[model samples]
Target chain A: MSRELTVVGLSHHTAPVEVRERLAAAAADAEAFLRRLVADCGVDEAVLLSTCNRIEVVTCSKAGHDPRQALTRLMVELSGIGAHDGDGLLFAMQGREAVRHVFRVASSLDSMIVGEPQILGQMKQQFEVSSSLEAAGPVLVRVFHKSFSVAKRVRTETGIASRSVSVAATAVDLASRIFETLDGRVVMLLGAGDTGETAARHFMAANVGQIMVANRTFETAVDLARELSATALPLERFRQYLPLADLVVGSAGGGQLLDAEDVREVLRERRGRPMFFIDLAVPRNFDPAINQLDGAYLYDIDDLAAVVEDNLGERRREAVRAETIVEAEVDQFWQWFEKLQVVPTIVELREYADSIRRGEVEKTLAKMQAISEEDRERIHQMTRAIVNKLLHHPTAVLKGEGSPTEESRLLSAVRRLFRLGDDT
Target chain B: MHTHTLMLFVASACYIGASLCYGASFSRREAPGARLAPWLLALGFGIHTLDIVRDVVSAGVLPVATFAGGFSFFAWLVVGIYLGLQARLSLAVVGALVSPLAFLAVTLDAIVRGDDVAVPQALRSPWLPVHVTLAFLGNAVFALAFAVSAVYLLQENLIKSRHTAGLIRRLPPLEKLDRLSAGFLMWGFPLLTLGIVSGGVWSANSTGHFWTGEPREILAALTWLLYAGLLQLRLLGGLHGRRAARWTIVAFSLLLTSYVAVNLLRLGTRHGLGLAG
Candidate 1:
């Protein structure tokens, strides 16, 4: 009997965050849970993945047992929830559907924020835990590695991961586009609004030359600056820093902070070097008319949102390409799996032939002790070659070199004919 | 009609093919085309090098001594420098612009301009090859700078207009282009200075005066001064981005017109305005 590979889980797609959070397993509990499935549930192979978004148990059952009920029972018991609690919340997929589901999960196709990259790493962490606990056997090992390559293929072949989807990323993208690089370029963060801090962090990560965070409250500015390892300035004196700033991000509260005249004065000080301004505030901080200046570019929150939306659309289109890659990989992996199915029978046939040859050669050698040692060796070699020749066609058939039906039929016939037994 | 000419033609065809691949890669935003483009350029460069060597061997003179030879040498240097930059930096997008420039240079070099003059005995010093080679190499690097600057300006416009998709996505970052152009200009400026100095020395030895105001000589001097000023501005004034890029483009244009186009035109003038002497 062929063992079944199954995955039973609850994800953000089918359950609320409250349910997902309750179902999530701590790191220590995850390993123990995988151990329980193998020790008590008659599972030959097991892997448990627990994340903020989902908790899934993947397993391959032993020959005579079905693991679905055991997995469901374990999940209910572990979460302290009734079996019928979140009716229709637990999804169960078996066989090829299970494989495809795992691939999608690993590639971030099924992520809450589609195209987000965290899911792949989360899956890898789960696999590592399963591996350390000795729960991942041949089947889970093959499937998990294939899932990683499928995710990488999706990333490179398609632009599914193209463009930044957040306001901070959009600001950084705009800054890079305008100035070409942030290296040796000064950035001034106007106000310590959350959005401003996020964008400033992005600039810091990009290795911008320097960052000066100015706020109306001097202590907040100083605190944020210390956190980011940047310079803090008083809001009143922010204009002094603007002349040296190649890029400026404004997320301060309330009225216009810099008018057109102020920008003009700064531009004169900068000698007309290009400056990009990303205004991430409500009611706007920079003068809208600063865009009219020759070397000045200003974008507000709405502009950044439009860019993010456009990128999300592009990512959706690229997701279609990513889906095609996933499908092709699934087909490739399925073929490998089908070939894996015949491996045990083929190994049985080779061992059966070799054992008979070795037995007959030992008997013949014992009786021919009066003959020379060279002739005795020759007899052994001759019998080994004949056994190999006799078994070559049967080995090929058992290994699925022929049609699938023919291969399976021949495999059964050979097993019975050689009395190789059902243990294989 | 000769084997080297035929080989040069083949190299031009390869460059044209590489240009199309890079163009398709940019428009389609696909990886296969971008991956194939650089290999095609490297192949063309190899064949182009062989073609130049064949000409130098058969003619018993440096390949930069004639109009067709000079352009071919310049094209070879452009592709050579471009391949180096491509290896060090991700410059497949720049290839879309550069591959065509190389093709044009090679095609012009293959045109058989019908005025093949011999090198004068007085002008046949060892410095002749060094001066011409350095000049062409400097010009080749500047041409690359021009391509990068053009891409930079295009990318800048896209960002300013708030349309940062498609072609803009294909380009290298704005800062990378700025730095790349500046680096090339800085390296080329000194070689250009040496080329000018050596050319002056060669001219004085042959014609007895280094300050003659021939039109080509004056134009060459002006091109050199413009690039010198651009470099100084970048070093002292933090001159970069749009202004530095614009000046690099202008200086390269002047170099092309005075160095290649004027020589090809071969106009009848009072000072005999050509490099043949």
Candidate 2:
């Protein structure tokens, strides 16, 4: 039977945001689930791929059965949720299409963010899990290795990975606009939440003059400030220094602490110099009226979302181009897979034909004891020619048909015609 | 005297070996040249050490109480420090360019000695070693800077003119060569300062001006100021790659010309050949 690969899963495209987030596997959890895939699931070879935006399982089987049902059932059992909840979220691709999906994913040509180097490392982890479980055979080893080379090509040959702009990076760009040089500017980093902490770190790397943290809880803010080697002051003290700061990025853990009147008082002291304000908080902390202040640049979460959306669109266009390259590469992989199926038949045909030629030629030579050395050499050359001439047509036909055709018919024909299997 | 002849022959061979190794390195652009560079450097250094040892042994004392003696002492001191730096930095490729100048200086030393020159008793003082050693080491550092700056200038010109080929690949990156040149300046400037100070101390009691006129002092000061300015620009202006490279070449050229001009003036032509005590 011909073996074919199958990828059966939904991703950010097919599923809703909520569904994708729930189905996605964290790096640590994907390994255990990968083992169960081959052990209890109907998978001969498998790799589990999980990232922030998508979760997919790719498998290969000779049985030609739809592995999706088995995989979704496996997902349901692992998740401990009702199978119906994930039933509508499933997507499937078979044979060559499955290989194309895997190549695209490994190359980061299918990620929500194209040319992001992180996905390559994630796919490598999945491959690592499969290898550790002894689930990846020679076929997957070939596919996984080729994926790295294809990824390297897309990275070097295209400008997709160069000069990338991310959200954190955009913040740095915006900061440069406000300050002539970070050589001597002070910042009031209003929160030390994960995103806020990350933004603070970026500010520090740019060599911001100094940073002051103001959070709802003074202790937590102080702790983060000390960790960053920045100073922390009270919430009430924030207004006193707001106008003194060159930049104010308020990711205030929660709630509006700065009003229109409050910012007006702050702006009054700020002079004519520009002050950059980024509110990453959900319920925008700064008054909407504060944005109208002269020399004040304010951006909220929605503005950042707009920037991310624009970038995502650009990412998709390059991803489409990359996808075309990956599809061609995957076709090459399938051709190699196909040739693998034709191997035993080719071997049996050549070996069986050669043995018959050897047996007859030897018997004829032995029967004539007066056969000269010249006659013996002539017989050897003739026997090789006869074998080649007889086997040439069938070998070409067998190798070309390879795996798309049902393999059993060809195997049986080789056995009966040559009586090959009986001797083995 | 025969040992002296043997010393000159061996030192010349060392220079030849170092030049051959460097030429090989630049041509082949491979490990054999880089590997041979250090060995050839060691061979040159070994012969140089033996030559110096034979000189002292043959003379009963350190050979130059005469102008010939000072020349030989300064020559070995310059080349000796250079060979030490080669061992330290593994810059035998640089030694290729320097070794010939070294051989020439030593040959000049031999010629001056063979002329049966008189020993200026005033020149032979406890201060002589300090003044000569510091001056020689300073020159050695300037020589290193000169070689690196020349390489930097060539690499920059090649890249700017968009002509890259085998030699460019063999050379270290521009930033590395620039830093190496700048590092030489940092080292040489202080040694130069000490040499000037010692020379001043030696000349303090003597009458009208010093043994040399104000021009050597002025030129040395000019070189020091240029290097100091270049180093400051490298640090504060964050100047790097080609801009910093060009400055290094300019500074090193000024430095080298100062030494050459001072030496020529010492040999006394129509040019002032200025004064003597």
Candidate 3:
């Protein structure tokens, strides 16, 4: 009898966006689907992770049962990705291979954008859904827990997820360095150009306190503000609102509009609270000298782009380090998983021998009519010692480390000799 | 070795372990090192405190009467205050910088002080403990500020040079570091002032003048003045970031120099009572 793990899925690497989106299940639906898989497909444990890029079902089956076909059939019926049509798109891995896949996916090593942090959170969400539905059992609990730990190890030991890979992201990241959270911090868009507007949208997504758009043309400002559901102001009135803005992103075509003196007065007014200036304008709307002011951080487009480029190369180097950590963790988890397989068989074999010995002793006792109670007690002790002595060698042998072939042979022989059922 | 000695050695060992953990956290790709480091430091701190109490009980006086004992007491306060800040801010990366400083102080004391040095007759006055306590506590806080300032400089340099990849993420946000360092400086300055004033009174009572004209005393005065100017700049003139961080390093270095000259080098007339000798 063999217990196996099977993972059947399609990811961005194997399938296009249309198929992935079609296959993806909502959290509630994924939970229900996992519960159904456990109840109806003879799967002992199951977890279904459904995201925009992938939908994976990891299943642990009962001994002597295969979960691949059942999972494939379920995928066809539920996700509408037919086994026949999804030939090149669908991928299925079994046992150690499946476990490795799950680890890599959770660690973001297998993500479309390697080292992105979202996949780990998504994996955790999937684990929670399966657990709440009572679909995840001991094996899956072990797997997912190890996956989470491995992901965490990769994140800390390597710089893979630490650096932002893009300029816009680095800009937002720099804002975070100034402010702990953008939640209640005002962001002022100093220009209505495409670059400034794009950055403003990023700030909006970060849940800034308010968005104020100012442009040379009031009409342009108003249009941009209305589109973003933000307030608009004329370019000249930007100074009036400067004190309220925690961050100013400038990208206008105009020449230096904010000089050192303008910023010095603003700082005096704001009482030296930190302000970040992202100058995306080519001519640099904010004077470079304003950066000399205390609590004022300035970054132009070229500066941010340079940071992004440098960080990408560094991330690539960190990825190699991250991969090593993942591989080491995979081997560790696999060793534990393999050891799990041998314990139950050894326990069953010992139990089978003990039960037979007990049955024989009872039969002998019943047949021994009028035997003294003291003599009966002595006989019981003798039988117990004999069973213990007789089982010691086999137990030692079973527990000892051996080659896989030799271990499996011994296990099978013990099962056959004692007539131990595989159901246990 | 005596049981007290053994206990102090154990405490030192724990501090070394904690330092390694904190150092490892800086380079680790995983979160375990950071998570484990604080608990290890706390464990070391408990053992260290126990050893200090044991030493005081056996000696019938505060162990800070001698240079070695003073260094040990200083290290203990540094670790204690670091742990306090860690509890409040979860500043594990800061621990990487702090733990080694503590390890150096403790190890130095253990190596240098094989036997207790005689307590100075002047230091036997009631003002002694007050002055020493305030001084060491101030030093501990300033040590924290120095570590934070160092980090600030490194982070600012990284951001300025556009090398945002490797270490920046491990650090706390720049503004948080700035705010925390400022808080430490504000807390330490008043205590340091009181400590200096108490030292002057102790000097006047013993030596007949507050102005000793000793090299150590002059350096101490200069250190105080530098810190005063730095604080004034920050509070009134609103000097922050790069300039403030650099001045903090300078002030702390001067303070350290004056402290080492007075205690380690015995730059002035002997203050010790020579009872143990």
lDDT of 3 by residue, A1-424 (tens): 3367889988899988877777674324765677677776788888888888898889888655777777777776665666687777778998778888998898888898788999999899888988888788888999999999988988877777778876667899988866767887898998887898889988888888889999999999999999999999999999999999999999888678898889989987886777889998888888887777777878888888888887777778888887788778777776666567667766776677677778898899999999999998898888879878988888888889987557767876876787564543
lDDT tens readout by residue for model 2, A110-198:
76767788888877877887778777877777878888778877775554554235666566655553344576678788877877888
TM-score of the first chain in candidate 1 relative to the native first chain: 0.80
Worst 10 residues of 3 chain A by lDDT: A23-32
Query: What is the C-alpha DockQ of each candidate?
Result: 0.29, 0.01, 0.32
Off by over 4 Å in 1: A25-28, A63-65, A178-186, A207-210, A226-230, A271-274, A292-295, A342-424, B28-30, B64-66, B111-127, B193-212, B259-261, B269-277
Model 1's CAPRI class is: acceptable
Ranking by TM-score: 1, 3, 2
Candidate that would win on lDDT: 1
Per-residue alpha-carbon lDDT of model 1 for A1-424, expressed as tens digits? 3456899888889878777777784324876677777887888888988888889988876433567777777777666668788457788888778888999999889998788999999899889989888898888999999999999989877788878999898888777766656777898999987889999988888889899999999999999999988899999999877898998999899779999999988887887677888898887999989887767889888888999999999999988888888888787776666566566656666787888888988886787658888888888888888988887876665654676556546655765687553444
User: RMSD in angstroms, all models?
Assistant: 8.2, 13.4, 9.0
TM-scores for chain B, listed for all candidates: 0.91, 0.77, 0.92
The whole-model C-alpha lDDT of candidate 1 against the native structure comes to: 0.79
Tens digits of lDDT, candidate 1, B60-135: 5566655666777777888898888777797887787778877886777777633344655754677777777877
